[model samples]
Target: CFYLLFNSVLFSVLSDVELRSYRWLQTMIFTVEEINRNPVLLPNLTLGYLATDTCLSEGSTLSAALSIVTGQDKAVTEQCTKAPNVSLFPFFFCAPHLQVSYFASCACLSDRTRYPTFLRTVPSDAFQAQAMARLLRQMGWSWVGVIYGDDAYGKSGVQLLIQELEGSGVCVDYTEVIPKSHALEKIKRIVERIQSSKAQVVVTFAISPDIEVLLKEVVRQNATDRQWIATEAWSTSTHYSAWSGISLVGTLGFALRRVDIQGLGSYLTQLSPEEHTNEQLVQNVWEEVFGCKFGKEMYSGPHCTGLEKVEVQGEAYFDVMYNVYKAVYAIANAIQDIFFFLPTYIKYGQSKKLISGVKFTTPVGELVHFDNNGDPSASYDIINWHMGAEGKVEFVKVGQFDAARGPQQDFQLDLINMENRLYIIQVPVSVCSESCPPGTRKAVQKGKPVCCYDCIPCATGEISNANSRECTKCLERFWSNTDRTECIPMLVEFLSFQDIMGIILSVLSIAGATLTGTVLTAFFYHRDTPLVRGNNSELSFLLLLSLKLCFLCALAFIGRPAPWSCMLRHSLFGISFVVCLACVLSKTVVVLVAFRETLPGSNIMRYFGPAQQRAGIFVCTLVQVLICVLWLVLAPPLPTESAGGELGARVVLLCAVGSVIGFSLVLGYIGLLAAICFLLAFFARKLPDNFNEAKFITFSMLIFCAVWIAFVPAYVSSPGKYTVAVEVFAILASSYGLLLCIFAPKCYIILLKPEKNTKKSMMAK
Candidate 1:
């Protein structure tokens, strides 16, 4: 079989060192098994296998194969070239570790004149250099010392690295290129030169074989104190453990490891078993050749049963090459499809026409045909290797580079959407520091590259999401009444003792006024006889009536309940006060008239009568009613529910025009009445005993008006307790004034004058 000879040349070396790390091999094997089980497209075609010992003796067999391919002339090379129209280079598939000499040698051999069939799976050296430059630019590393292997790999890496660094605003302090094959001695020399140069950080690019040798030399030379940085390649055991005394270890290249094989086998088993005929047949052939079971020991690595028993599996040897094998098979299938189908598929039926429709699925994912200039028209994976257990290694997938997406802002591959790829377990550098900005989030989409998502701020009292358009409202305790632009200190309700005191004082004032009113009414009507027949005692009676009314009105507002209650209560009480005030005014007018008429000959005052006094009362009372009507019509009260459903609504019980009218009218009338009483008192200062009552009436009015007027401001301005006290005092003063004015003189005359009593007794005898 074509595969038998391929296997012999491929597996030139088979040992535990190569077989121990089965990750990459396992991934490849699973992919092949899946493909073999599901050969739907090529139903009749059988898959085959080949293995190689490229890792043997530092990959000498690989180098020999590359050299043979590179030694060819242009004509011979063209014969092996896959396709001229393909964008990616000559090799069908290639993976290079970027080891200084090896990479350079491989790149050199890949020249169009040398080997047209060579193609690379990893990024070109230029890409790596650009990435390094980007990292340095971000870090603000102004200068660095470059120490590299003097061979092809190191030289090429350094050139690209320098070019990228220079383009991105970094200055190389000095470059020290060392020979790749000189081993530990070369490292010592470079370390000494780097130390003398005083570079802050050293960038080294070398193969594993050379890294260990150089690290030992650097320690011996006492240059291990120097800070050193490198790409992910240096994370290998050769460089990691070998670098003895370095104070710092940091990397700038792709750094990641491990692929999750969870659930991989079960997923592949679902593929059709009949399609896996070729794989099974090949396994059977190998089993017969090796004189052991095919899948048990050959497919899986050796498992130790006892002290002397070791199960050797063929898969352990060549399974890691599954990806490579699939890549070859895919190419073969494409070639066959292109050659056989083009004849019928193409318009002119030409088999030699450019095979642009070629495509295939590989272990990694999908592989589409290339475009011109050896540039892959399909997606590519970026990966890095890290040192693992027992001197083994692991591969970490970073991100995918898709040309279909837009390029990076800095003209590099945009890793924006690739931040969440399975390869990059850690967050990407581009988004980590600045977190998708204020209006964005990490988001990925198929077909088009997903940029960060946008976060929409909420409206008033609402909260916004970090990565979405959704928003929510704030809780009641954390009220943001306005837009969520800011959060403010919340408002809370707290009833103070002072407020309650005000209300309580107000209640006492009202009760005292009511009591005074009851007393006044009782004195006026409870008696079987009239207290006054004309304006003589009319003034005293009216004054008492007015004080009682005022007290009652004050009582209405004592509680300070709802605004509506204040409005209604104030209206009713105001009207009552006005009527009582009218009575006082009428009495004052009568007194003024009586005093004027009693004067020698004042014709203008001669029209004084009880009818006139009664008429005055009616006029004043009517005017007071009109004022109350105006107040009610102009301003209405609000209900309690509007202000957040609380009993206290944000209503204006602030006694607007109505209160002003009530107070002004009552006070104005009282002032006028007091002035008239004062004038009477002054004129009748020396009159008869019954008429001396005018002086007392004047004094009582003055006290009543003054006290109540003072209470006005306290009642209107003071909020809670003091206001209540002021109101109570005002009511007491007015009530006592009225009571004294009406009965004080009469009580003195009746109780203290025994002569008048005796005289009346003698007249009766």
Candidate 2:
């Protein structure tokens, strides 16, 4: 005979609480009765039970223990053998000490040496605390506040949670112990510290009743913004069902894996006072469920009609209800195996060990089994409390945290609370500060964590796209694009013949060359005329040819730069302009000397003849040619790419002049020649010759000097291809000025107004 005592009450009770403990008792009873009726399975075995109520008191547990263990209710030496026990005080130790240590184990019944027959359906607090630790680390929450009850279970659970969260990059910011008796001031102070702390996350390991007290205090303080990590002890507890002030909306925690109990719904629906009147199990649940006495005078609400549906109360019997059903079937299966297969098994402990290998699947899909420690294998449903339609509470399945997988995976907190039209973000934020967006990096504030910081924009040529702890320097030879998130290659720019500005300059250069050709043609056609021959026709012809070459040289400065173009662009420009300048100097000298030797047939004018002027022009022009040859040999401009300059993501393709001093010398020598040409032409402007050319030469020298002077600042300020464009523009402007000012007036007289093509019209200035 299995004389079992089922306790209908718990260690404590609260208002509007779900009757989970009572449901566990009824499930065990239903399982025993169902097994006894199955003749084919256990034909000869019949199990019996004597049920009692602890009345939510330690004294009640002691009284129930004495009556079940010994026939004389006070005397307790030992039981006859191992029957069924409801003794919360397992007589193996002192009673009050056992109650104190219930939090450490299971009412201290887990000590196999002292109470080898004690067994429980509920997984102990040890495994739940370990699971809570794993959940915290998975969420990447390192700083947390812990609140615990002073009772045995809460005391031991807090210790275990701290031990588990220790080395996993998690630590407790504060630990508060709730007293066993309701100390209002102590609870209020503990909650104030929690609400005011910098940590946005907190973990609690307290009994259901203590949680209610702490939550009431929390609700009063309006501390609804923290992420609460809960354990199994109070995660599914219904003690806080009516407190609407505290939102508790996005709380994350572990919950027991639920399974559907087969036929339990049918059994609960079939309860009635008319049928099965002798069954005490039926009368006890029926009275409390409908809030009425079975035979009392007053009617509370609904009487035990027993035809009621089970769906109304079925939600309460999920997690712990399934565990109780599995425990009973395991004991039944072990008895069956002992009698039929292992006939020699007589010891109760050996038969209990056989329960380890029992496996079965209930009506629900979850498979039930046990590990060697008699605890269920670690698997928890990660849940979030979501506010649904019409402010209804819903426990949404956000993710899963399994011990079999890696420390952290399979969690998406962003999926919860999405359908609510009020909020676009899925979860309520539980961070000290919003994450820094892209293009900005985090600047850690003083005496604060990396999570709590100020956002600072990335510096020039640097980038940080996402939540960055610090701004990183851009890589060498690479620059941050317009957006700071990425680095790209710099743009290489150069002067080109095809671009808009380059095309206009190139067209001007060509037009200047054409004008010079027209002027030379007119001079050749008028070879015997006084206006053409009076100004030393040989030198005038040479100067006109040099100006044409200078105009054409401006065309070389356009288009994509390369090794060959870079080497010749500036060199050709310098040498051709110098030749034109040398020719101008020769004509200026010829004008002065011819006017000075006009008194008689003097040999002074012989020295300034056409042949002599030609020789001097050749000697002056050859000096520039020698300087260019040495410049090309020593430091020639070559094609090169320089990146990561003032402009970002653009590559500048300017031909890099190999030597700075050589480049300076080239420009400086050109300027020196123009200065000399201007001064000499200015002095000889008033020469007394009818066809004096020094006036036109003076104006052209003034224009040429002005262009190069402007080129210095424009060239230095511009970058990349534009820098080369400035120099090219200077060449075209000066060439065009010389062509327009000096040659245009003569060509107009030679072709358009042939009347003024005489020496009298030329020497009028």
Candidate 3:
């Protein structure tokens, strides 16, 4: 006879009797009877099982394991060919006997060195932890609370879960352990923590019993707002579902993949005390399931009718029986392999080696195999607890997690249900902070997890899209939009004709030029007049033409700067100003020399003739032309873009002075000529008569010097198109000064005061 030792939490010793555990016990017996009936697999072998009530006690479990290893139990006889112990309880003690577990999923049991004789049909908690972590990440539940039972199973599973959560952006807000003693005070404290935590998602890693105790405390406090994540240990257990109330609604969990056993329901329904009169466990189950006792029992319950039928209680209750069935079939397959393939008698320790290597398909077409760690392939059905049509809690299959597929493709949700499910429609938000929107980035709080953060707006020149962690800088020629969500082409800015300032400056430039033309017309109409001749008509005409050019040149600076306009504007202004100054200087010298000649026979009048005056003006103007020519050839100004102004949002299009030295020389030469003209004309101011040309020239030169002197600082300090505006203002001011001071009086005397334009009036003192 082959002996199968069945250990479970039975007889209601440490806790209340669990009907699901009773069903597991019956499932083991049913599988054993079925295997013995099969002739082709184990022809002459008959298998028998020894059931032990562990009462969920560690000492009882250890004692059962020791009895199997030492062969101390009277049930183990010398005729027994093999003894493979199948435990439905979590085994912490190691032994030599091949112990196969139906549901001991603790990851530490996978260590082959410590538990070499141990094999399990259920997957290890390591894979479950990974599956849980993946599910949390996929659901976007970054901030959550964790509550685990204070045992090797809970501690090991939580440790694995936390390890798997590293770098996954999932953070635990609080972790509390439920005491195994089921202390009310400790469980209350855990409930208090859950109530106080801001995390709306709480993960419970515990068995059904410990979870039941904790859930009662939670209900006592009425703390049911949280979305609970359940591990496989109690995710589908009916023990808690009975009393969990509406609190378990919207709870999501992972459960072992369920499979149906053929004829197992019929086998359970046919169970009766008459068939198993010697089996006390069968009587206890019948009494518990039917609420009746047998043979005048001590308890005050009704007697068994022997006609009560056993029916499947729930899907979860029946699903776990499949693991029990697989455990027995796995041992049977190993024994058959050892007898048929190896052709050797199975030794005491050799059974585990054969079982570890056995690979076969079940009658239900499911493959049964184990990895090197003696664990089956990890696969889970995602369950969502929601109110059913009957207004009771229902576990709805919503997704799946298969470890055979790669990590990227392992977890998947049923799209049809996920989209239409009532609980998922609102999709409970469990994060510590809401996701940052576009135009903002996440700023993690100090001394807090990454999930706890603040959303900060992007800087002026930077941008951040939705869910961005950091701000991105815009390109040099680009600028961020007002919302900082995207980069846009920068606004190109210059003194364009369309701008208000440009229009004003342009109007002023044209008005100045038109006024200069009117003045020129007046001078020409009075070309033979004494005032015109007295001021030297040829130099006066040249000065008027140069002033007109100066006024028009300001227009070049008013428009969008280009290569041609950039070089032309500066050169024209420089040359025009120099010519106007030269004409003034020549007139001043001629006036002073003529006055000296009148005092005594000075002979200076003959030396400072018309030809000499014209030659002097030509020479001075030529010098400025030569300087402008050299400036344009060596390092000419060019139109360029500058990033400046508020937030650098505008690209200022302006002409860049390629060579500072050349530009400075142009202004310096003009300043030098003005200064000389101003000094000479001041000296010649009081030499003669009514409207002294030298006095007018002196005032115009003073105005020119002051305008250019202020222009230097204003040009250097002004920004963007304003700099061009300042330059244009300076040109118009100086040109208007020269035109008004030098020519206004001449035009006044010529047009309005014709008597004062006489040669005799000009000669008067």
Candidate 4:
């Protein structure tokens, strides 16, 4: 009995994969040789073997098939018997599917009539197509390129892959054909297309030779950084491994599940000339793996004595080689069962039933069985091409793809550190363009995808926060940060006592109050002196007290505004100045009337005496108090916030005066009283210099009027806290004018010239 094996491709320069298949062929031979030696199984007969390369073409495959059928290229010492033809190669899966195009009568492998003898240990290519689709989806890759050779195997597999890919959420950006012949110019154009296109990731479905040609062009074009999703067709091929400069660094692909046969290493360890000298296949494998020549012949290189070890060489490529080992055992078990259980002769179609669903346990403790479609369930490994020294490659299994396990659980990739020029531990980028960050909205280009866009900043009163796709308008109560990335509570802005302006003003106001206190003390100490009693002494005392209140009113303007402070700010200002102005009016009148009475026999002092002067001051102050009460009852000052002022981003907290009429009345009343006093004092400016206070009072009233007149326009135009600041400044300026102008002369004389303080010295003028 004999078993014949056929492989699709073999090249000396690109023969690592071809050599691997040859190792698998050796495994099949070793299995038969072991069985022939065993006493319990196939003891009465020995199994012979013949394996050949088909070169991945119809001509080569047909030629190899014809050679096997004609019984040529066989050793003369082998047994002469007809053997059942069986093929378990993975590459042959698409061949029978594409044969319907060549021959119209031929159906696919759906029934036994089209091809009765087709059987395989490896699953069909259909499972691989689904696996590719599911793998791309698991990685969130939707846009990609499809690259395949223009052959029957390529056409059939690509068609199935496209069907599965469409069922998933993926779309192909471009599909290209690799020429059957070695056309360098055509391949160059394809590589240039790949470099210029927008797609950064590509999916390849081609054989080793086609993949090698395309990858070499990719190296020439220096498109090494692009992601490549390799199919099972070329993922495990070692042809491109030694091309160290040709970078395939981050290539993700599907590979066959690996297994180990028990005691296979020990069985291969005892290869020597003492057992078999005529085994030319064993000698060739030993030379190819160990890099040595065999026998005692004189040669240019070192020779193997057949004493060389071959223990682990077969296990190194177990992913592919294990299939052949399983296939041999599958056939052996089927034949043994059929020969033992039934009397039927073992034919090709009849023997396939016994092996279809046979279960066995591998040395790795994994259970293997086939499904109803005459194919095993999908169990592919997700592998990455890791680069090693001296142009070698190591296939690392980073994930797995199993159809029976469902999509979500099946394709789980190990998170790896995919490095770039600027960042480490970054995910591999696959896109037409990068995404827009916060504070910007995406503006799509005319003909590009939505992913490709320009970023635009948000408009006023709006913000885009933390990668937001659109801008949102901010509420009136909230404001945006300077970066426009987030919203924050607005600041309460006012001239509070904590501010620098407030602090400075507060200190000045307290000092002014203290100074007023000092002056009041001085006056009290000299209450009965002639200078203190020069005017109606009661009126003089009242004016000083009113000025003290004016200085204290400035404190109300310095603090954070509340209802009480707001009302008191203007009310205290109005009433204090009115009291002071009443005192001035009374004194100016008294100066005129008293001088006239001295000139003649006038009796006006009796009619308008000290009591009448006090009445005049009382009536004037009462009028202002009435106005303030009415203003408060009608439209009182209330605390509020101001937006859209000179201060951006700060909302001013202010005491908003409710009525224009009330504010105007408050200032107008003070102005009228000052105007009357100014007129009265100006006419009396020529009174006796020694006893006259009219000139000083005249100048003081003039300054007061000028200050109030200017304050009206300034107060209306000033913003929030500044409006109050203007009013406070005007009050201090006018009060200081009255304080210094009307009293400095009296203090100077009383302190410096005490003799002039007598009543006789005052009357001479």
Query: Which of the numbered candidates is closest to the native, going by highest TM-score?
Result: 3
lDDT of 2 by residue, 316-433 (tens): 4265556556656556555566566553443433554554555555445656665554445555666666555555445565656555565555333434233342221233334556
**Candidate 1 lDDT, 489-594, residue by residue in tens:** 4443222224565555556556756665665564455232322333345544565666666665665544434556546654565555555555555555555555
Q: lDDT: which candidate is best?
A: 3
Which window of ten consecutive residues has the lowest lDDT sum in model 2?
93-102
In candidate 3 the C-alpha lDDT for residue 290 amounts to: 74
The better-scoring model by lDDT among 1 and 3 is: 3
What overall lDDT goes with each candidate model? 0.44, 0.64, 0.80, 0.68
Superposition TM-score, candidate 2 onto the true structure: 0.65
RMSD, candidate 4, Å: 10.7
Q: Could you give me the TM-score of model 4 versus the true structure?
A: 0.55
Candidate 3 or 4, higher TM-score? Answer: 3
* CA displacement after TM-score superposition, residue 8 of candidate 4 (Å): 8.9
Per-candidate TM equals 0.45, 0.65, 0.89, 0.55
Model 1: CA > 4 A from native: 1-333, 341-503, 518-522, 525-543, 558-567, 598-606, 640-765
Tell me the spans in candidate 2 whose CA falls farther than 4 Å from its real position.
Answer: 1-9, 13-182, 186-205, 218-229, 242-252, 260-314, 317-376, 383-399, 406-448, 452-500, 589-616, 619-623, 626-635, 639-652, 682-699, 740-765
Query: Which of the two, 2 or 4, has more lDDT?
Result: 4
- Arranged by lDDT, best first: 3, 4, 2, 1
Q: Global CA lDDT of candidate 3, please?
A: 0.80
Any idea what lDDT model 4 has?
A: 0.68
Total backbone collisions for each predicted model: 27, 17, 0, 4
